[model samples]
Each structure stands twice: as C-alpha cells, then as structure tokens.
Target: MWFRRDLRLGDNPALLAAAADGAEVVPLFVVDPTFATAGTPRRALLHDCLVALDTSLRETGGIGLVIRHGDPGDVVPAIADELDATSVVVSRDYAPYGRRRDAGVADSLADHDRTLRGVGSPYAVDPGQVRKGDGDTYSVFTPFSKVWRRTGWQHPHPAPGDDVRWVGAGSTGVVSDPLGERPVAGCTLPEAGEGAALDRWRRFIDTSGASDGSSRSAVAAYDDLRDRPDLTGTSRLSPDLKWGTVHPRTLLADLDASGSGEEGHTVFSSELAWRDFYADVLFRQPHSAWENLNPKLDTIEVDTGKQGEEKFARWCAGNTGFGIVDAGMRQLLATGWMHNRVRMITASFLVKDLHLPWQWGARWFMDHLVDGDLASNNHGWQWAAGTGTDAAPYFRVFNPTLQQERYDPDGAYVERWVEDPSEPMLDHRVERTEALRRLKAVTGR
Candidate 1:
C-alpha cells in the first residue's frame, strides 16, 4: 500500500481495501527527490509523520514502512518489479503533481501487467461532489455551504481486520534523515500518527467539557471567539487535517455528536467545507495555483521589481512597518504556523500595502509553514489578491492596525512575536490612508 497525504492507518479506505484483498502487503513510503528539492517545512513534517506511522505499524505486527528515495515514477515500478507484486493500491490524490505522478506510475505498472488501484481521496466529501440545483458549481461561500450541508457524509470505515499478512522487502539500506538531524528551530510539533491524532481529539473534547460538561458548549461560543488571535479559540487541527493524520469524516462525526448550537457548528462546519471547496477549485483549475483564479484580475498590476523584492523581504523577515503584519510573519517563522485572522492581515499587507505579487507570499508560506497546503495556500493568496472565487473586492483592503486593535485588543499576540515589544502602536487611520494612497498610485486606481 502506497501512502501519500493519507498517513493514518485507521479509517483509511485504501489501506483497508488493500489489506482485505488477502495478499501480503508491502507497505511502502517513497521520499520523492523532487520533494526534497522543494525543501519546505512540510517536507520535514512529512518525515516526522512517517516516523510515527512506522512506529504504529510496528506495534500492529506489520513490517516497517519501506523508505525509498527517487522519483516515484521510477522507484515505485522498480519496487513492484523487484517484488513481483500483483497490484498496487493507494489513496487517491488531487494535487497537480500528484495526479501526474500517479498516472505515470499506473502506466509503468500496466507494462508489467500489474494493476494500480485507487481508493477514495482524503476528503470526506470529494471536491465538486456538491453543487447547486442548476448543476453548476457554487461560486459564493454562503450558497455553497447550504448545499454542502444538505450533501452530508458517510460514516468512516474501520481499520482492516488483523488477519491481513505482510510481505517484507529486504531493506534498501539507504540511511537517510529526511527531517534532518533536528526539528526546525522554534517549532515544537504536535505528536504525529494515528494514535496522536485520536489522542488529541480526545483531549480537546475532554478539556472542552471539563469547564462546561457539554461537548457542544465550547462550540456554541466558537463563532464569537474564533476571530480572537490571543485566545486558543479555533480548533488547532489544521496541521493534522492538512497532512491527513486524521480523516475528515471522523471530525465531522464528532462535531455532529457534540450538538454544538446551530450558529457555532454552522460556522465551524463551513470552515471545514472551505477545505473541500479549495481542493475542488484546485483540481479543476490547477493553473490558478500560479495565476489569478478570476482571469479578469490578471490585468491587475503588481510591482515585481527590485522595490517589490525589497518589500517582500521586509514582509518575510517580519520587519514590515505594520505590527500585525510583522507579528504574523514572525509567528509563522517561529512556530511554523500562524493564527487564521493574522494570516488574512499579513496576506492583505503583502498584496495591498507591499504591492508584491501574491505568488511571492504563497511561496514563502509554502517554504516555512508545516501546515501549508497547496490548495488552501494558493486559494488563500488569490483571495487576498482579490482574484479568487468569492474573493473580497479588489478595493476592500485590510487595515492592519485596525485589525490589530480589533482582534488583538490587548496586543498580547503582537507582543508575543514582534521584536520591538515597546514600539508605540501605529495609528490605524493614518496607516490606512497612507496604504490606500500607495496602492492607488501603483495601480493607477
């Protein structure tokens, strides 16, 4: 069984089906060299997740995950040939590179008269599954959410029965440290693998109830608290969900059982739906990963010169004049993640204030964020650039200082991440005026 984003063993369709076929499973993990060339923080996180997966499989009496380093198009077929395998089963992936790689592998396996089978994707609801009554994709979020809710989900399948046996391949004897010698600086990652994901869910539920004795209680207040940067208000599950450490069905089932009030659960569920929405958008329009989602906005001018590079560096280095923007960037650098609200604020500064292309910011995030997902990150940048489906209008720029005052009221989040802790906060009204003038001048608006 080949694992990509779907890392967990429990409730995994492909792994379970593969095991059910009654053939000895050669569980394999290939570290694609192209992935290393990308060298993003996610690469390291993937390595850690693999280590956790190997440990989990060991406890279950399966052979350790075979680690190979090469282009999967070359390596996967070579492995199959060496083992004389009958079929290769894997979880389906939706990303551009993933789709291409899988196709190549399938063709190669076909040459050997072996089949390559794909189970369902990582999402609970496959992208583009839910649409309007007219059979067209819903572009706006409100209508999309309504239809998504109506389109419910299936109960996740259990892990395969233990009767499944394994076939071992002799170790490739390649000593590799995929995640490097140590974890990234300032990143204290959560425990990884299936056990860790389930444990975290349990702890979240327990602590949420400890104060109110109701699973739904915390959720009822989620909408009110989710925007606050200083509080641990949002579920810190993005990283797990991004990496497929936990299945979305499992999360949705828990939320459904919680009975969190209509508004709160509605809001939280909508955010989850956005994940599927972006994945669908990417699958259908992969070029939007590099260009504007709305082609009309491709004409929107951006500064991509030395001046733009200088501003981009400032933003990346967390030295932007805006406290909220700098704080968010620094937080991402330090922790490999940033609060959702801060992400919007910083992204707005990059596209609006700095006048740099959104791709620059997206690439930087991809390189640093452990939770970085291509679909989400690309769509997020496009949203900030006013070039995505349901995007904020081109003129609706975020006022960073006002955002700080509103979301970080006491400045705790800023103080925690910014270097100059004592600098007087910039005036939002003043900064907003100046930023607007700069943007207008650059775009001839």
Candidate 2:
C-alpha cells in the first residue's frame, strides 16, 4: 500500500482494499527530496504523522512503514521490484505534481507487469464530480455549493476484515528512527493514526454540545464567530483534513445526522466545498499555481525590485507598520497557521500594499503552514489578486486600517502579536492616507 496524504487507516479506501486483498502489504512512504527542499514547518508535522503511522502498523503485527528517501518515481518502482509485488494501490491525488508523479510510477510499474489501482479520493465529492446540468464546471460558489450538497457520497467503509492474511515483504535491513525520538520545537500536533482521528472526532461531537440540540443550530452561529480571530469559533480541523487524518465524507455524514438547519449547515458545508472547488480549478489549470488565474490580468503590475523585495521581507518578518497585518504574519510564523479572515487581509496587503506578486506570498505560505495545500494556497492567492474565478475584484482593495477597526475593533487580535502594541494611533487616519497613497503609486492603480 502506498501512503500519500491519506495517512490514517480507518475510512481509508485504498488502505482498506489493500489489506483486504490479502497481500503481504509492504506499507511504503517515500520521503521525496522535493518535499524537503520546500522546507515548510508542515514537513516536520508530516514526519511526525509518519512516526505515528509506523506505530499503528507495528501494533497490527506488520513490518511497520518502509521509509525510502528518493524521487518517488524512481523509488516506488524499485521498491515494488524488490518486493516482487503484484500490484500497487493508493488513494487518488489531484494536485498537478501528484498527478504527474503517480503517472510516472504507474508507467514504471506496468513495465514490471504489475497493476496500479487507484481508489477514490478522501473527499466526499471529488473535484469536478459535482457540475452544472450541462456538464460544465460551476465557476460561482453558491451554485456549485448547491449541487455539492445534493450530490451523493459514499458511506464510510469499515476497517479491513481480519480474515485477510499478510504476506510480509522480507527484511530490507533498513531501520528508521523511532517516532518518540523526533524533535520538534513547541509543536503540539494532534495524535497520528486512525484511532487518534476517531477519538478526536468523538471528543469534539460529544463534548462540544453541538450534537445535543440540533446540528444546524450548533454551526449556525459559525458564520458570525468564524470571523472573530480571538475566538475558537471555527472547527480546528483543517490540519486533520489536509493530512487526510479524517475523511471529508465522515465529517459530512456526522453533519447530516446532526439535523442542523439549512442555513448554518449550508455555510459550514460551503467551506468544505471550497476545498474541492480549488482542487478542480488547479487540476484543470496547473499554470495558475504560479501565474494569474485570469490571463487578461497577467499584465497586472507588481514591484520586484530591491525596494519591493525589502518590503516583502518586512511583511514576511512581521514588521509591517500595520498592526493587524503584522499580527497575522506573526501568527503564521509562530503557529504555522492563520485564520481565514486574516489570510485575506494579509494577502491583500502583500499584493496591494507591497505590490508583490501573489506567487511570492503563496510560496511563503507553502513553506510554513501545516495546512498549506497547493490548490487552496494558489487559488487563494489568485483570488486575492483578483485574477481567479469568483475572485474579489482588483479595485476592491482591503484598507488595513479600516479592516482592523472593523474586525479587530478592540485591537485584541492585533495586540496579541504586535510588538509593544498600543491603541490605534490618534493620527492613524493621516498615516492610513499616506499608506494608501504609497500603495497606489507602487501598484500604479
């Protein structure tokens, strides 16, 4: 069984089928150098998840995960050849790199007369699956969301039946560092493995008090609280979902059973749908990962000179004079994640104020965030650049001062991360006007 993003075993279609096929599964994870070169904080988190997975496999009386460091295209086939395996199975991945890499592996395996099988993705509704009646993709979020909710999803599969016997891949004499020995600074990552995911879900639903009354009621207030940076209003499940620690289908099923009303449930469900929407957008248009999504806007000017670089460096270093923008940047540096609302504001500042291209910000996020997904990060940057489907138009710039006044009215969130923070300055209006003028000059808008 090849493990990609789908780390956990329960509700894992590929892992379940692999175990059921009664093949001595040489559970494998290839640590691609490409991932290491990217060097995000999430890299450490991924390593931690692998350690947890190895532990789980050990408890199942298997040889634990086989860790190989190389290009997956080269290593996967070599490993398969060494094991003399009949087939390789994995959950489908939609990212451009994943798609191309998997194809290379498939072609290599075919040369060895081994079959490569792919199960459906972790998503309840695969990207591009829910489409308009005319078989075209939906560009707008509302209609896409409406169809997504009406779409059918598969039920969670049970853990593989114990009747399946293992055919162990003989010792390759490779030893991996124990999970307990890995050192990470100040990372309180969630437990890794199928059991951990289930346990977390149980704790959330049972203790959260959302299940007691109505499902819709519990999440109905989410729309309001989700925007509050200081509150734990939104579900802290993005990292879990990103790593496939929990299946999206399972989450949707739970929400459905809660009988949450349409409005609240719909809003919550739309966030989930955004995941697929971005994936499909990226899958169909990989170039958008580095360029503007809308070609006509490719001419949108940005500063890439020494001054621009210095400003971008300050933005990344969380030294921006604006309290709210700096706060969001610092939060990401400290915790490897940022709230969605702040993400928009910070992105706007980078592109509009600093006049840096969206790709620069996207790359920075990818190198830091635990929940940094290619589709989400790239599409999000394009949206902020006003060059993507359903984008915030370019003219709709986010005024950092006004935004802070509106969202962080008390300056609580800003104060939390800003160095030696004070109340909004008495001459803040004058400062904001000057800042806006600088931005207009730099962006030529």
Candidate 3:
C-alpha cells in the first residue's frame, strides 16, 4: 500500500483493499523532495506521523513503512518492479499537483505491466461526487451542501481483518530514516500520529472518557463559543484532518452515533462540508488554486509595489497595530494555527484595509499553517477577496476595531499574543470606502 495523505491504518479503505486477497502488503511512503515547500511545522509533524505509522504497522502487522526519497513517479514504479508487484493501491488525491503526479505514476506502472488502483480518498464524499441535477458542480456552498448530505457517504472500512504477510523495509533494497529528523518549527505543534489524532478527536466529541476536566464536549459549545479566540471552544482538529490521521467518515460516523440533531453537531458537520466543497471547486478548476475564480474580480485594484510589500511585511510580523489582527497573525506565527474567525478578520484586513492582494496573504498562510491544504487555503482566500464560490461580498469590509470589540471583548486573546502592538497602519473607515470604490470601478456595482 502506497501511503500518501492517509497515514493511519484504521478506517483506511485503500489499505484494507490492498490486503483483501491475503496478499503480502508492503507499506510504502516516498519522501518527495517537492514537499520541502511545506512549512517547517508541517514537515516536522509529517516526520512524527510517519514514525507513528511505522510503530502501528510493527505492532499490528509485523512490518514497517518503507521510506524512499525521490519523485514518486520514478520511486513508486521502480519499487513495484523490484517487488514484482502486480498492482499498487492508494487513496486518490484530488489537488492539481497530486492528480498530475498520480497520473504520471499510473502511466509509469503500466509500462511495467503493473496497475495503480485508487480505492478511496481523504474526504468522506470525494470531490465531484456531489453535483446538481444537470451534473455540473455547485457554485455556492449551501446548495452543494444540501446535495452532499443527500448523496451521503459510505461507512468507514474497518482495518484489515486477516493476519496478512508483510514486506519489511530491510528487504525493500532501499534505505532511509525510519523516523526522520524533525524540522525546526518556530512554534509548538500538537502531538503527531494516529493515536494522538484519535485521542484529540475523542476529546473534541466527548467520546473519550478523558475530557481534560471539562464538563462539556468542545463540539457541544462550538456553535456558541467558536467565534471567541479567548476560549478553547474549537476542535483544533484541522491538522489531524490535513494529515488524514482520522478520516472525515470516522468523525461523521461518531457524530451519527451521537446526537446528530444537536445544533453543534449540525454546525460542525457543515464545516466539514465546506472542506469538501472547496476541494470540489479546485478539482474542477485547477487554475482557481491561484487565479480568481470569478473573472470579474480580476480588475479589482490591489497594491503590489513597495508600499504593499511594507504593509505585508508588517502584517506578517504581527505589527499591524490592530489588536485583533495582530493577535491572530501572532497566533499563526507562534502556533502555525489560528482561530477560524480570526482568519477571516486578518484576511479582510489585508484585502480591504491594506488593499493587498489576497494571494499574498494566501501564500503567507500556506507557508505557515500546519493544516494548510491547497483547495481550502487558496479558495478561502478567494472567499475573503470576493472572488470565489461564496457570498463574502466585496462591499462588506470587516472593521478591525468593531471585530475586536465583538469577538475579543475582554482583550484576553490580543493580550495573549501581542506584547506591544503599534498604532493602526490605516483607518478601517477610510479603507472600507476605498475598497468599495475599487470594486465599483471594476464591475460598476
């Protein structure tokens, strides 16, 4: 089984399929050099995850992950040829780069009379599964979510049941670090691996008996307290989801067994739906990864010169003078993660207050977030810029002061991150007007 995103063995459809016929499975992971672009936190977390996967394989299946270093197109097929394997199995990847990489690997495998079989994906409902009656993708989230719910998803496959034979890394004829050295991440990352992931999820949904001494599940209060950065009201599970330590199907199944009718459960389910929706959008329009999904917004004026660079540098350093924005940026710098509400606030500050391109902020985020996925990060930036599939209207600019007063009323979140914030770089009122003027100039709205 070729492990890419799906690291955990439990509920992994592709892994189970690989061992279905009682085949001696070789658990392989290629360390692609291209992954260097991922930020340090992500790189470090990935190393821990790989080590954890190896541990699980050793404990349960009497084997370990085979570590190879190179382009997957060459490494995968070469490994297959060496093993004389008939087929390689994997969970499908939907991002532009992953898709292209998989296609190349498939062709290379065909040359050796081998096949690459894709059985499942990282998402509960794979991209392109939910569509309108006309079979076209949904442009808006609500309609797409409704169809997605109706389309539903399969129950997660159990981990391989049969005691299967295995190929050890020593016999693979390739050698690399079993537990790779950790990259130097600037901030403290959560514990990495499948056990950690499952533990975190159980605590979030209150499935685990241990609650960190809290009376309520984080999910129970998610709808009410999720907006507050001061409290631990959110799941903090994005990193796990990004790494595929626990599948969305597993989460959904747990929610189903719990009271699915609760508002918190319903709201959290919708959040997962947003993840699927963005993936679908990127799957259909790969260029939307960096380009504006709505072409009309192409003419929207943004700063890209020295002035913009200075402003962006200030934003990146968390010195923007706006308490809430600074706090959010600092949180990201410190933890490689930020609260969802603050993400929107900081994004709007960049696009509307400082008049910078959303792409700049998006790139910065992708360089920093441990949980960053291309479809979610880029399309989310487009949503803030009013150039993606959502109703984040360009006319509705976020006011940083009002936002701080509303979301961080006690000033605790800002205080936690910002030691001494500077004066506001630009007045929200002035920039809000300038932003609307630019939008009107582009589309005559």
Candidate 4:
C-alpha cells in the first residue's frame, strides 16, 4: 500500500483492498522533494503523521513502513520489482501534480508487468464523479451540492481485520528532516497523527459509542457557534482531513451514527461538500489551480511593484493594523490555521483593501496552512477575490473592521493574536471605493 495523504490505517479503503489481496502487503511512503518543500508547517505535521503511521503499523500489523525519497516513478517500480509484487495499490489522487505523478508511476509499473491500482480516495465522493443531469461539471456550489447529496456516498471501507499478515516493512528509516522543525515563532499546532485526530473528533461529538445516535451533544451546537471565532466552536479537523488521518467518509458515517437530522450536522456535511466541490472544479480544470476561473477579473489592475511588495510584506507579517485582518493574518502566520470567517475577511482585505492580487495571498496561505489543499486554498482565494466560479460578487467587498465588530463581538480573538499591531496600513473605505472602481474598469458588468 502506497501512502500519500492517507496516513492512517483505519477506514482506509486502499489498505484494506491491499490486505484483501492476501498476506504480506508492503506499506510504503515516498517523500517527494516538491511536496516536502511546499511549506514548513505541513512539512512538520506530515513528518509527525508519518511517525504515527509507522508506530501504528508496527503495533498493529508488526510490519515496517518503507520510507523512500526522490521520484516515486522510479522508487515505486524499483520497490515493486525488488519485492516481485504483482500490483501496487493506493488511494486515488485528484490534485493535478499527484495525478500526473501517479500516472507516471503506473506506466513504470506496467513496464515491469506490474499494475498500479487505485481504490477509493481521500474524499467521501471522489472528484470527477458528481455532475449535473446534463453530465457537465457544476461550477456553482449550491446546485452541485444538491446533486452531490442526491448522489450520496458509499459507507467507509472497514480497517484491516485482525490477524492480517504483513511483509517488507522494517528496512529503511523514515525521513528525519522535514522542511522546518519549528512552527511559526509563537504559533501552537495541535497534537499530530491518527490518535490525536480521533481524540479531537470524539471531544467534538462529546459522546462515545459504536452505535448511539441520540447521545450527541457537541455537534448540536455547531451551527450556533461555528461562526464565532472567539469561542472553540469549529471542529478543528481540517488539518487532519488534509492529512487523511481521518477520512471524510468516516466523519460522515459518525455524524450519521450520531443522528443526521440536526441543522449542525447538515451544515457541517455541506462544508465537506464544499471541499469536494473545489476538488472537482480543479480536477476538471487543472489550470484553475493558478489562473482565474472567471476571466472578467483578469484585466483588473493590482497594486504590484515595490509599493505593493511592501504592503504585501506587512500583510504577511500580520502588520496590516485592521484589527480583524491583523488578527487573522497573525493567526495564520503564528499557527498554520485561521478561522473560516476570518479567512474570508483577511482574503478580502488583501485583494480589495490592499489592492494586491489574490494569488499573492493564496501563495502565502499555501505556504503557511497545515491544511492547505491547493484546490480549496486557490479556489477559496478566488471566491473572495470575485474571480472564481460562483464566487462572492465583486461589489461585495468585505469590511474587515465591521467583520471584527460582528464576529469578534468581544474582541477576544483579535486581542489573542494581535498583541501589538502596527498602524492601519490603509483606509478601508478608500480602498473599498478604489476596488469597486478597478472592478468597474475591468468588467463594467
């Protein structure tokens, strides 16, 4: 079993499939240089995740996880040829780079008379599966979500049954040096790995049982408190989800097992749909990863040049001075995460208030976020910049101060992150006006 994002052994469809193929399934993890250099926070978290996976595999199956570095196209086939394995199994990859890399590996395997097979994916509903009755990909989230719900998903595949045999594990050492060992100067990251992921999920539900739908307590309040950044209202699960420590199917199943009729459950499920939606969008249009989904916003002038560089530097350092924007950026800079509402606010501030290109901020996020999946991060930035499919309309620029007044009602969130904020970089009102003017100049819609 080749592990990419799916680090955990539980509820992993591909691993189970590999085990079903009979005993002595070799588990391998390849550390690609590109993936490792992507960012510091995720790099560190990924290392911890791999360590956890090694421990879990060792304790559960008494197998060693083969750690490799460099190109998988060569490394995977080399390992398969060495083991004389008939096939290599992995969860499907939807990201452009991952897809290409897997394809290359598959070809190499085929040359050696071996097969590279895919099972389920990291998502409940894999991308390129859900579509409209017309059979075209849905660009708008709501209609896509409707069809996605109607299509539903398969039950999570069970873990490897007890008494399964394993092979070819205890050989090479896992990578010790990740991109960076330290997190941002003052940022605190959550505990890493599968155990930590399950623990967080258990606490969020505030109930435990293999089957007890009526015992749920915490999720019931999700809809009420999810938007409040001041309180621990959200499930802090994105990073885990990104790493595939816990699958979306697992979460959906547990939510169902905990009674699915609640508004909180429905909304949280929809959020998962949104994640899949962005992945689907990127799957169909790989260019959208770095380019605009909507062309109208392409002509808009951004504050780029030396002045823009300095402004961007301030934003990256969380010195923007707008209370909520500063706090949110600091939250990201310090930690590799930010509240969703604050994400939108800070994104809008970067694109509209700072008059910078959305790509600048998006790149920064991909560098900082432990959960930065390219599809979600880039599309989300586009949504805020009004340059994406079914995006926030251009005229609706978010007012950061007003957002703080509304979401950070008690100022607790802002105060927590921005101990000594810099002066307001620019006036929001003036920037908002200028933003509208720029949009009008480009599209005239």
Candidate 5:
C-alpha cells in the first residue's frame, strides 16, 4: 500500500483494499524531495509519523515500511517492478500537486502493466460527490454543508486484517530516508503517529466540563467554548487529520455514535463538513488555490511595497501589538500550532488591518503551521480577506481590539503567549476605516 496523507493502519480503506487484492502488501512511503518546501514543522511531523508507522509495521506484520526517495512517478513504479507486484493501491489525493503526481505515477505504473487503484480519500465525502439539484457546486458554505450532511457517509472500513503480510520484507534494501533526519525548525511538535493520535483522541473524548467550566469534550461544550482559545475548546486533531493519522470517517463514526443530534456534536460535525467543503472547492477549481473565487475582489488595492512588508513581518513575529494576533503567531512559532479562534484573528489583521495580500500571509502560514493543508490555509486566508468561495463579505473585517475584548475577555490567552507585548503596529480603528474604504472603492457600492 502506498501511503501519502493517509498514514495510520486503522480504518484505512486503501490499506484494506490492497490487502484484499493481494496476500501480501508492501507498505511504501516515498520521501519526494519535490515537496521539500512543505515547511519545517510539517516535515518534522511527517518524519515522526513515519518512524511511528515503521514501528507499527514491524510489530504487527513482522516487516518495515519501505523507504524510497525520488520523484514518486519514478520511485513507486521502480519499487513495484522490483517486487514484481501486480498492482499499486493508494488513497485518493485531491490537492492539485498531489492529483498531478498521482496521475504521473499511474501512467508510469501502466507502462509496466501494473494497475494503480485509488480507494478512499482524506475526506468524509469525496469532492464532486455532493452537488445541487442542477448539478452545480455550491459557492456558499451553508448550502454546501447541508447537502454534505444529507449525502451521508459510508461506514469506516476496518484496518488491514491480521493475515496480510509484507511483500518486500527482507529482499528490499533501504537507503536515503528523510524521516531519519530531524527537521531544522526545532519547535517542539505535537505528538506524532497513529498511537499518539488515538491516545489524544481518547483524552479528547474523555475530557469533561471543568470546575471553571473551561475544558470540555468534543461533543459536550464545543458549541459554547470553541471560540474561547483559553479553554482548549477546539479539537487539536487538525494535524492528525492533515496527516490522516485518523481518518475523518473514523472520527465521524465516533461522533455519530456519541449522538449527532446534540448541538455541540452537530456543530462539530458541521466543522468537519466545512473541511470537506473547502477540499471540494479546491479540487474543482484548482486555480482558486491562488486566485480569488470571486474575481471582483481582485480590484481591492493590496499593499505589497516595503512598508506593507514591515507591517506583515511584525504580524508574523507576533509583534503586531494587538494582544490576540501576537499571541496566535507566537503560539504557532513556539508549538507549531495555534488555536483556530486566534488563527482567524491573526489572519484578519494581516489582510484587513495590515492591508497585505492574503496569499502572502497564506504562504507564510504554510511555511510555519504543522497542520497547514493548502486548501484549508489558503481558503481560510481568503475567507478572512473576502476573496474565496463561501467568503465573508468584504466589509466584514475583524476589529482586532474588539476580538481581543470579546474572545480574550480574561486576557489569559494573550498573557500566555505575549510576554513582552509591543504597541499596536497600526491603529485598529484607522486601518478598519481604510480597509472599508478600499472595499467600497473596489465593489463600487
């Protein structure tokens, strides 16, 4: 089985399909230097997950994961040819780069009479599966999410049965494993791999309302406390979801069993739907990854000169002087992660408050966040900037001070990350006025 985003063995449809296809399955992971730009935190998380997966392979199936390095189109087929494997199986990749890479690998495999089959994907509902009555995609999230829920999901597939063994067990000699090297970022990353993912999920499941009414379970208080970063209100599973350590199907099943009718569970499930919605948006409109979904927003004058750069640099280093924005960036720099509420606050400041292009901030985030998936990160930036599918209105700029007052009411989140806070880089009220001026000029409203 060729592993990409889908890393874990449990509830992996691709692995089960591969095992069912052949008596022995070869667990192959290619460390393509092509993706070397995928940020230090992401690389480090991937490396740790690979090490964890290798351990699982040996303990469970008496074999190790095959470590290969090169372009996947060349390396995967060559490895298959060496093993005389009949076919190569993988989970579907929806990202533009991944889609192109998978196609190339498939063509290469076909040249040698090997079949390349894709089974499940990283999402609950595959892109293009849910559409309007007119066979059109929803440009808004609310309608899309409703359709996504009504579409339903298949049951989680069990992991590969105990009978499946490794095909390239002893004969294949490994070389040049990137997973063996440590990432340069040096930020202490979150727990990595399948076991760690499950353990974290268990803790999240067992978590209950605290005495202060702060901490809560996934379905218990998420609706109430999710926007409160000080409470650890949101699930820290995005990194795992990004790496597919735990499939959305698995999480969905558990959430459904826990009672999807409850408000907290329903809202949490809707968030999952949003993830799928963004993926679908990116898949169907690949160029939307860089450009705005609504073209008219391009008319908004975005600052890109040195002055804007200086402002942006401060925002990135958590020196924007806005307590919430600075807190989020520092949290990201120190832990390779940040709270979702803070993410929105920081993104809004960069695009609206700083008047910088959202894409620049998106790229910066991709180079920093461990859980940065291109679809989610870029679209999220666009959402804040009012330039994406299901975008918020252009006038809906987030006021940093207001956000701080509302979300960080106790100032706990801000104090935790910003030790020596700086003065406001730009006056929030002034920037808010300028941002609205630019929006009105562009929209002609």
Candidate 6:
C-alpha cells in the first residue's frame, strides 16, 4: 500500500484493498522531493509520524514501512517491478498536483501490465460528490454546506485484520531520508503519530463529558468560544486531518453518537462542512488555487511594487504594527500555527489595509504553516480578499483594532505573541475607504 496523505493504518480503505487477496502488503511511503517546500514544522512532523507508523507496524506483526526517496512516478513503478507486484493500491488524491502525479504513475505502471488501484480518499465525501439539482457546483458556501450535510458519508472502514501480512523492502535498499540533514524549525510542534491524534481527539470531543467532571464537551462549548483567540476553543485537529492521522468520519461518528443535534455539535459539524466545501471548490476549479475564483474581482488593483514587497516583509516578520495581525504572524512564526480568527484578521489586513494581492500572503502561509493544505489555505486567503467562493465582501475590510478588541477582549492572546507591537503601518480609516474606492472602480457599486 502506497501512503501519501493518509498516514494511519486504521480506517484506511487502500490498505484493506491491498490485503484483500491475502497478498503480502508492502507498506511503502515515497518521499517526493517536492514536499520539501513545505515548512520545517510540517517536515519534522512527517518524520516523527513515519517513525511512529513503523513502530505501530512492528507491534502489529508487520515488517517496517519502506522508505524510498525520488519522484513517485519513477520510484513506485520501479519498486513494483522489483517486487513483481501486479498492482499498487492508493487512497485517491483530488488536488491538482497529486492528480497529475498519480496519472503519471498509472501510465508508467500500465506499461508493465500493472494496475494502479485507487480506493477511498482522504475526505469523508470525495469532492464533486455533492452538487445541485442541475449537477452544477455551488459557488456559495451556505447552499453547498447544506447539500454537503445532506450527502453525508459512510462509516469509516475498520483497521486491517491480523491476517494481513507485511513485508519489508530492505532487499532493494535505495532508501534515503527524504528530508536529508536539513534542520527543522526551532518552534515547538504538536505531537506526531496516530496514537497522539486519537488521544487529542478524545480530549477534544470528551466522549464522556463527565470524564473531567464538566457538564459539556469541548465540542459543546465550541460555538460560544471558537472565535476567541485567548481560549483553546477550537479543536487543534487541523494538522492531524492534514496528515490523515485521523479520518473525518471518525470525528463525525463520535459527534453522531454524542448527540450531534446539539448546537455545539451542529456548529462543529458545519466547520467540517466548510472543509468539504473548500475541497469541492478546489477540485472543480483547480486554477483558483492561485487565481481568483471570482474573476470579476480580478479588476481590484493590488500592490506588487517595491513598497508592497517592503510591507509584505514587515507583515511576515510580525512587525506590521497591528496588534492582532502582528500577534497572528508571530504565532505562526513561533508555532507554525495561528488561531483561525486571527488568520482572517491578518489576511484581511494584507489584502485590504496594505492593498497587497492575497496571493502574496497565501504563499507566505504555505511556506510557514504546519497545517497548510493547498485547498484550504489558498481559498481562505481568497475568501478574506473577497475573491473566492462565498468571499467576504470587499467593503467588509477587517479593522484590526476592533477585531482585537472584540475577539481578544482580555488582550491575552495579543500579549502572548506581541511583546512589543509597532505603530500602525497604515491607518485603518484611510485604508478602508481606499479599499472601498478600489472595489467601486471595479464593480461600479
């Protein structure tokens, strides 16, 4: 079984498919050099997860995971040839790059009369599955989310049985560390591996709310507290989901069992729905990953000159002089993670306040964020920039001071990340008017 995003053994459809005929399953992970562009926190986490997966495999009476480094198209077929394997099983990938990579691999495998079998996907419901009566994709979030919830998903697959056999790829030893000797980022990272993911999920969902003698689970309180940056209100499950340490179905199942009808659970489910919504959007319109999904919004002027570059550098270095924006940027720098609310505030400031293109901020985020998934991160920046599906209106520029006051009332979150914030880079009043003027010029509104 070839592993890409899906790292865990449990609830893995491709793994089960690989072992269906009682064949010796080779747990292989190809280290593509392209992934090196991801932030150090992500690479370090991947390394840790690989180690954890190997330990799990050994304990389950399987040989260790095979590590091969190269382009997967070349490496996968070569390995299959070496093992005389008839087919390669994998979880379907919907992202543009992944789709292209898989297509190339399949073509190579076909030349050798081998099959490339794709089973389940990382998402609970694959992209393009949910649609309107006319079979068209929804450009707005509300209707898309409503249909997504209705479409639902099947129960997660069970882990492979003990009868499944594992074989090591030690004989064809060309294995090399994908990350090489590069240094990981200095910031603290979340614990890696399947076990850690499950533990964290349990803590977040509080299967038994009474476990901690609290009347409500974290999911129950999620609605009220999710917007507050000062509290750990949101589930810190993004990285886990990104790496596929835990499946979305597992979380959904837990919610269903714990009374999903409750407001808190309902809100949390909607958050999950947003994830699916974004994936579907990206799948249907791949170019939106970099270009604006709403082409009409493309007319809005964006700064890309030396002044813009200087401002971008300040924003990245967390010296933007906006308290909440600075805090969010610094938090990303320090932990490779930033609160969701702050992400919007920072993004809005970049696009509206600084008059910079959302792509500039999006690229920076992809380079630094541990949980940065292409579909989510780029679309999120576009959403904040008023240039994506269900985008926030261009006139709705976020005032960092008001946002800081409303979300971080105690100023605790700001204090934690911004020990010494600089003066305001640009006046919000002036910028907000300018942003609106630009929008008017484009839309004649």
**The best candidate in terms of lDDT:** 3
Structure candidate 3, residue pairs in collision: none
TM-score of each: 0.90, 0.87, 0.96, 0.94, 0.96, 0.95
Residue-level lDDT tens digits of model 3 in 1-445: 9999999989998988888778878999999999998888888878888888988988887667899888998999998988889999999999999999999999999998899999999997899999888888898999988888888888878877648777756545545444556789888899988899988888788732222344657786677788889888788889989989989999998775233487878888889999999999999999999999999989788999999999999999999899999999999989999999999999999999999999999999998998988999999899988888866988888889999999888999999999897888877888899999999999999
RMSD of 6: 2.3
Candidate 4 regions off by >4 Å?
171-186, 207-216, 257-260
Native RMSD of candidate 3 (Å)? 2.0
Give per-residue CA lDDT, model 4, range 362-393, as digits (tens).
99999899888899999999999989977598
Off by over 4 Å in 6: 169-179, 207-214, 257-260
The CA-based lDDT of model 1 is what? 0.77
Q: Which of the two candidates, 2 or 3, achieves a greater TM-score against the reference?
A: 3
For residues 1-445, write the lDDT of model 2, one tens digit per residue: 8888888767888977777646666678878768755535677777777877777766664657777778989988987887787888899998889999999999999999987788878577887698888899887777877787778688887765555454432345444433333435243455555567766655544434343243433465566667777655566677778788788788777665233555545567778888878887887788878877777666655778998798788889787778888899989888888989899998988877676888999998888787888888889888887778765877667888888898778888888988665443224445335445654554566
Q: Tell me the number of clashing residue pairs for each predicted model.
A: 0, 4, 0, 1, 0, 0
Cand. 2 Cα-lDDT: 0.74
* Model 2 clashes, total count: 4
Clashing pairs in 6: none
RMSD of candidates 1 onward, in order: 3.4, 3.9, 2.0, 3.6, 1.9, 2.3
Off by over 4 Å in 2: 167-196, 207-220, 257-262, 422-445
lDDT of 5 by residue, 224-281 (tens): 7788877777778999999999988887787753334667778888889889999999
